[model samples]
Target chain A: MASSKAQAGQTLWAKMPKANAELFALTYGSLVTELVRDYEDPIEVNAQLERIGHSIGVRCVDELLSKADSSNLGSAVTQCGNLRDTAEVVSKVGFRMFLGIQAEVGGYSQDQRSFSIYLQENPLSTFVELPTIGDEQSSSSPSGGLDDLRKLKYSNLYCGVIRGALEMVNLKVECTIVRDTLKGDELNEIRVELKEVLSDGAGDDYKEE
Target chain B: MTVHAIHIFDRKGKTLFTKRYTTTKQQLMQDAEQVSEQRKLIFGMLFSLRELVGSLTPEGGSPALQSVKTGAGTLHCYETISGLRIALYTNNNPVMNTLPGARAAGGESTSITSFQTALKYIYSEIWVECVVRSPLYRPEDIQVDPLEGRDNNAGRFDIKSTNFEVKLDAYLSSMPWFR
Candidate 1:
């Protein structure tokens, strides 16, 4: 099953439209820099990035659905039987098709309500490093301090993207950046918890006869 | 084979678009109320039938409603992963229904697979292109037209683009059962 999903992701990645990775990275970096400068708080900048990502995610999901169909992946890409399937698709196919990167799904909770996505390489943070002030450990500093460096989530946009895309498919999920390579972690990880599965009310009016 | 109409519905059972190929004067003269009522009735029946079929199937998979045949006509259904349902209503051939063995007598039998393929083609090729990709199309916004207020559920957000209508008509007219 893992191999098949990986193969699917590879095939989709090949078919995807290509863009200059450097330019994309630089543009995202400039946007984050501007947000940090304007907001003057790393936490607020994270929230703003997520808001922007939510709008992008809502529109990208439709494109993803149509692209999946056009790629001839058929039912495999469309119908996700369980949360595990959804996670695998999001990591292997979703990330690959969108960002042209491979991510692994692991760390499933015992209740099967949540899982973690481990991304070895984040395209958004290719040339990014959290700036730290040497010997200035003051907590009162509004910007550029070791304290603010730890609070900044460089790739929080991915969390919002996952949340918004899943909501469109009636899966209400909460995604958070649990681990970041920018924060000295070996890999970046996004933790996703299934909050609720929205009912489309198809059987609401059905009366037993 | 004669196609009477085509209807598309969103996941919540709201009518997105309904195109009736009015052949006779009787059908052409169907009032707005009658048409809207018919759309609601068809959707209700489909929803109930789908649930019934899903429950009755021995296999542990969703068995969606494929077709419904009556004395007058037949209804073929195809639903996408996004929960969009597209139904085609066509006149049934009396000769084939009377003698099941005579289905092979004609080379042009309206098999379920062919209809399913056609419906999927309409979805992936026509509907996705014309309606989904259009910048002006907003699926969630409900229009406040007083004329369609009689049936609130009939026209929530219709595919009212002239380009979409022209393409859909052209594709359906090219089908074998259109006439």
Candidate 2:
């Protein structure tokens, strides 16, 4: 069967399955807000959040790839693609499947070792407010310069998600937050660097991005 | 709209986690053994029903059976591409039950998809955070040791149930149907 996404060319983005950004925002907000209440150190909470995202990524990949198999889309791009094609499928198809958004793919390395997925819009930011350094806050020096340097990395969870998802798909990739709206950047870009391919090519027999 | 309980089962019909909330019925399960037995039975029934429905439909059916109502309550199920199965069992609201002619004729399919979706998010958001990321819990440890009498006990992963319980309570309480 042709993918529902492919059939609706002109209105594909509009036709794609969408969820209320509020739902994700609130859920993520709750987790983040709770971490703030529990840990005195925001940096520690940042690491924990990424770790949590990694766990989520591994399982989310399971949900994504398996569902794709049922639709036959999983096999069409299954494996045997060069690094560029794999990255393209991941940034384009995978993003659409999960978040109902398309990512801009660019900044690929000549050695085929890295690429970046630019998220023009972030659904996870609906409820995210960059934490401000209170005037009386003692975590940083009196100078706001030091405070600015101490970024909370609210979207690091997403970086971990990329790493976790890629690892599960048999591509050992290091996912890093190249840019994030949380830190005043206009775009949320995640740079994915291939570390090593696992012994089993696709993780599963025919797992796609 | 209230989620009574959420159960995650592996491919072999073993229970991974079955967290009950205020909405779950008491008489259906009296003790731990009874709870496990009832879960096993529910798993078996759902498995059979899925196969039955799949066989009855043609190629490309309208997304597997959505929800089914039994005499007790309603069962909303979501199956992952992998073998993990998450089922949300909820009791019919007393108010809905009292509506005349509604019970006999069968009511409309509840918008339980939202609840199912939330549960899937919970699987990724909470369960993975608690079970998969924690140093205390090992994925390999989720196994059965008959001699130790921990059969089908989710491989002794030692889940921090209290944390999940608190969050689930908060999550259900936040839903509009909780009252």
Candidate 3:
């Protein structure tokens, strides 16, 4: 009985059922499709996508905390501790808890306020092709320069989620997809930069201003 | 301890999914309207208590509310930092419900924490798999219709995620304390 109970605590992701990846791909595909159809400008599409992502991030963070309330989580959520610990939890815990992805947290800033989460295995790209030369969508830059990507951040919403969730935890941070395989980068990396930590009883003041 | 039901809510006080595992004699589990009424009251009461606890904190004194108990077992509530609320009201046997306390405190809460953790696991994993990940259901906030009438479908709202139900049932039955 004890062994089984122990197993329950450890059976984190491997034991849990996997979400239908096709469904995830198709879902994202449909969302992008809707955004494209609605907005003429790709910049607008990116903003809307980020907004959608922010809402999900804010909620998904709650879901993440709800599912696993560990001692580390208590500190991490209440008053976020050191930079490394916070990034480790975000890269490791957040991904595995939600998508069963094991990401490596590294590449810290000189001041220790920024870091990159290397997403080696991302489910979002299983069906998504990398943006490359000769991709002939109107949204794509006519010159096909790097400027094309300036308009569309394909997975900006995921980054938005991280930012939104961090803000909800009283940690004001900026999360952006610095590198993406979808954008011809060798790997996908999420760069998180700490802006400020909203301290005790000062949350409303930030909102009021 | 017996968790009679699990109610999941969004940050905006919307009911995402509610699953009742055990039947209670006090509130007829089979009655649709009565159960809905009870569920709503439970949501309201829990929400109010949570807000009160957060508000009543002396300026700069920030402790939070965990659980509330009465003759009707205990209401173990776990609120996420982002304001999502999940409440589990159990009607365990007298011994399992032994020495009920006014609030979720000390040792009783350790077990509750572990259980809540497991429940959280289910929420993030199974529920996300079956509910949120579904493109058809929503990528937006779930509409929490306070006035949406109750249906006969298990005496409440139906998210129709059979996979979630199956996984949750399997997990609960595997637990030694589930009885």
Using TM-score as the measure, which candidate wins? 1
**TM-scores of the candidates, chain A only:** 0.89, 0.77, 0.78
Candidate 3, B62-139: lDDT as tens digits: 556667888867777776665556777665342333334523444555565656666566666666567655544443
Q: Candidates' interface RMSDs, in order?
A: 3.2, 9.8, 7.2
Q: Predictions ranked by DockQ, top down?
A: 1, 3, 2
Considering lDDT, which of the candidate structures 2 and 3 is the better prediction for this target?
Answer: 3
Preferred candidate (DockQ higher): 1 or 2: 1
DockQ score of each predicted structure, in the order shown: 0.30, 0.05, 0.16
Residue range A28-89, candidate 2, lDDT tens digits: 87887677656646677678888888777776666555445433454434443466766766
Model 2 docking grade: incorrect
Please identify model 3 stretches exceeding 4 Å from their true place.
A1-40, A48-52, A55-159, A163-209, B21-26, B29-34, B52-64, B92-114, B133-158
Tens-place lDDT per residue, model 1, A81-159, is 7999999988988898889888999999999899999999999998997766553665544556555756888899998
Pairs of residues at least 3 apart in sequence or in different chains that clash in candidate 3 = A67-B120
Question: What DockQ score does model 2 reach against the true complex?
Answer: 0.05
Worst 10 residues of 2 chain B by lDDT: B139-148
lDDT of 3 by residue, A86-169 (tens): 676676667766677767779999999999989887787678764554555545433434344445778877788888778767
Q: For this target, which candidate reaches the highest lDDT against the unseen true structure?
A: 1
Q: Scored by CA lDDT, what does every candidate get?
A: 0.76, 0.63, 0.64
> Which stretch of 10 consecutive residues in model 1 chain A shows the poorest summed lDDT?
A200-209
